[model samples]
Target: MTAFKPALILESVDEIPESAYIWHWKTEHHFPFHKHNKGQLTYVEGGAAFLYTRDKTYFLPARHYMWVPPGVEHYFQHRYPANYVRTIYFFTDEDDTSDPFYTRTGIYPVNNLLLEMILYTSKWDGNVLPGTKGYRFVKAIKNILPDISEQPLPITLPTTENTRLKPVLKFIQENLAESLTLESVGQEFNYSERTLIRLFRSTMDISFFQYLKLARMIRAMGYLLETDKTISEIAWDTGYNSVSAFSNTFYKLVGKRPSDFQ
Candidate 1:
């Protein structure tokens, strides 16, 4: 298993002065769990991801945005290889004492207007002249943001206070591509297979096998979008011994053929 490293502070938005810094990141491993003091609005431009906080885990796919409130500790897991994410971190006034805002986590439709703005803002070179087209574009993004919240929390994690399960969860994430069995997982942690199953079901509200499949499917999506590898290659890389089995699972979860996506 590869070591998961802490997130490298990839360009801070504050460094760009008046304009926000829009950046794209491609990740293969779980981003070392961490948080920032400033707020962040992130969108999964391509691939699938699992976002985990102290209280819950949110599954994010394309066309959905997540707003992380300031000082919230959060981490991300790329279920698939070649995970691509676009993020915009805007700086707000520190002295402005505003009401406590809920972290917005929901599935929102991606319209042409939003997609166009994302493309334009992503390439903005930080030259925003007053009363110019770029200036108006920036203003439009801010105006549309308040209307973004359709709900407070969309996908919720099963466990909220299971600190004891952290090590087990981390083990599953780290060894996702390996042929993991309940017996093996239990032996490694000195628990009986039944006990392990009970614990997993109680803590995550999903069976161990289901969680593992979700993790694998997440990684498969990343590979599909980020690499030139064929579907067979991706399936092998993601631990499927048979291409047919991998294809069937992929079709079931993503609702499209891998070749069609390519």
Candidate 2:
């Protein structure tokens, strides 16, 4: 049998200087499905990228990172032009008894300190080992990471090959300001209500209705967090007929008021 070869591999843990490392992305590139023995925090200092695993595909824009647990098979694509991609990997062998969040994987918000530390550590060529530092940098990181905060953007990303939901997702994205329904989509796509429901459940692991709501919610989130748009404006822009309806739906799905993300 042929051995499984990874597209990228770091030397063994003992050979490395720290618990994490970084690399830059030059031009657009795609890394085929692969697995890492250690958990990874994938962040980019510039541009954006997307990650696809067995269960879901994640869009990681700038100022964000996607966490990947150890031994999970996944693939990634870097954006076009030269981009600065920074990845920090934690050795799977590190037994952190208190780190509860290490096992969960998703896209998350990045604070200034976390961003700075990632950038700072990426500069370290490991001149000094763990204990020789003024303060144990790697040790500090292990503790700091768990509390960085997790902002779930629960959006339905399109699949690579089987994209029954692609046009539906695209419609939702482009027409976020308008009302929608699976029945309406079925009519447009020439699919029956029964087929649409089945395909959506199979393709996205969610109902067509749920995915539509999530798609709206994701766009609403971006406007809420990234812009100065009024909640009422965002409400209408995100397909809600009323601000109250939008707020309720946003709160229900996001577990926070739309204003909170601002």
Candidate 3:
């Protein structure tokens, strides 16, 4: 993938900068490594978004969300233009809460209530000052957050330390634009095709094709957002044979056409 410009650290601007905060953006830019004093739940309703931490990379298409516990240092890029992104900062007294996705950063689904509440609260920011009854309407959304804590999350690539698989993963990432195959990669790494398949599927819990598609789609998404390249040009740049092929793959993986992000 091409390099992106440096990310910017955003400062808290909520009038009542206490237990909770809601922020939204619709731009093609990056948020640099920063943390909120409160735990965070991020929602992306339009375009594409990519969240990066020290270890893992997460992809958020439209309608997906990710949870970041308080003080989890991270940065994210607007993977496509016209991004409608919102995040809710939460304050919890119990840091040791037991939720499947709590504190563990991963992409998950968003329900209608979650989506509506986030957008509804965003509208009340400056208009409804704190201590007002309308302000508590936002806090009421907090009660809904705990219910979906156990929802299944789509885990993409996480940084692995295993020496045998580490270099192979790195190779796949570094060569995402190439016509890569498990057999070829395994041959280069001195492993059998079946061994490679098993390792990728069993160890990583993601198949080789799934992982590669993830890489290619990720790069393609960035191209669609950050550059003005034609869809066909991006298709070729990302190893797709044609524009339609790239669009199909993007739609299959991301649930939206390439032009939708454009």
Candidate 4:
């Protein structure tokens, strides 16, 4: 089936209510590549959201949020249905000292304090004008972001446009459930293992194994949030034969067990 396209409002021209605004919705769909005049904060309350930029795909799992700076061209991909996506948009002053956090894009796990603050905005929609209670509350959330969102989730996969690597990456994504390895994949694509490794490093700046692990984790997160599948089922679906092995690797990378993450 073809992907559903959501109507996008370009903040650059849209008549917004104030410097601080909010828009949110829940759907198991995606937004085509788009951008805005003000920086955006996207919080995924259910399921997961994948934010795709020019050369990277970031995984925003459940209970996590992502910050996209102003004018950054990107798109959203939701793998499962009924995913709640909450967004807050705000512009910073030119001389604002905390502008650094508003300049970079990153995925951050939500803490209890921040989570409560974000959920409080659920009663609010549209431009939260200055000098209002809602406006001050949301602005305070933005200001504390730099301090709270210090460590970014490194669940991003570099994308590629190289003719040779593109098809190879696509093949890997399509066959994640299979027993895929560098040697087997190289044979399938008619390359020596060494040559395939070199291609990955040169084009993506990531080793072959590192890329595979991240790709598997991304898929696993989708299954965990989107399905009622057992942990063992999800593990095998992501190419791990042993549940313990899968859980260990997941904890090492995601800092949470599969059960906990779910």
**TM-score, cand. 1:** 0.60
lDDT of 2 at 164: 71
* Whole-model lDDT values for every prediction: 0.63, 0.66, 0.69, 0.82
List, residue by residue over 11-127, the lDDT tens digit for candidate 4. 322366356777666655455678877778988776677889988999887778899987788988776554467788885655234457778888988999999998888887767
How do all models score by TM-score? 0.60, 0.69, 0.61, 0.86
Tell me how far candidate 3 lies from the true structure as C-alpha RMSD in angstroms.
Answer: 7.1
Q: Candidates ranked by lDDT, best first?
A: 4, 3, 2, 1
- Per-residue C-alpha lDDT of model 2 across residues 1-262, encoded as one tens digit per residue: 1122223344432246344543433345466677666677777665556678876667665677888877788877754232566666665445534465777677887889888777766555422344545226645665677777555555545452467767766666687787787677789889899998888777767877677677677677666655668999988888888899888988887678878755
Across 68-92, the per-residue lDDT of candidate 3 in tens digits comes to 7766778777646655677676655
Q: State, as a TM-score between 0 and 1, how close model 3 is to the true structure.
A: 0.61
lDDT accuracy of residue 202 in candidate 1: 82
User: How accurate locally is residue 173 in candidate 1, as Cα lDDT from 0 to 100?
Assistant: 68
lDDT of 1 by residue, 1-262 (tens): 1222324343244453455445556565455556655456676766666777876677666566676765667777666443456666554443213423334434444557776776666655433444567656765664466565544422344434566677777787678767889998888888888998888888777888777776677666656766788898888877788989988887876667767644
lDDT leader: 4
RMSD of 4: 3.9
* Candidate number of the best TM-score: 4
Over 4 Å off, model 1: 1-39, 43-51, 55-72, 75-86, 89-103, 106-112, 122-136, 142-163
* C-alpha RMSD for every candidate: 7.3, 6.1, 7.1, 3.9
Superposed on all Cα atoms, model 1 deviates from the true structure by an RMSD in Å of: 7.3
User: Stretches of candidate 2 above 4 Å error?
Assistant: 1-19, 24-34, 44-51, 58-64, 74-85, 96-100, 109-116, 125-136, 147-163
For candidate 3, give the lDDT. Answer: 0.69
Better of 2 and 3 by lDDT: 3
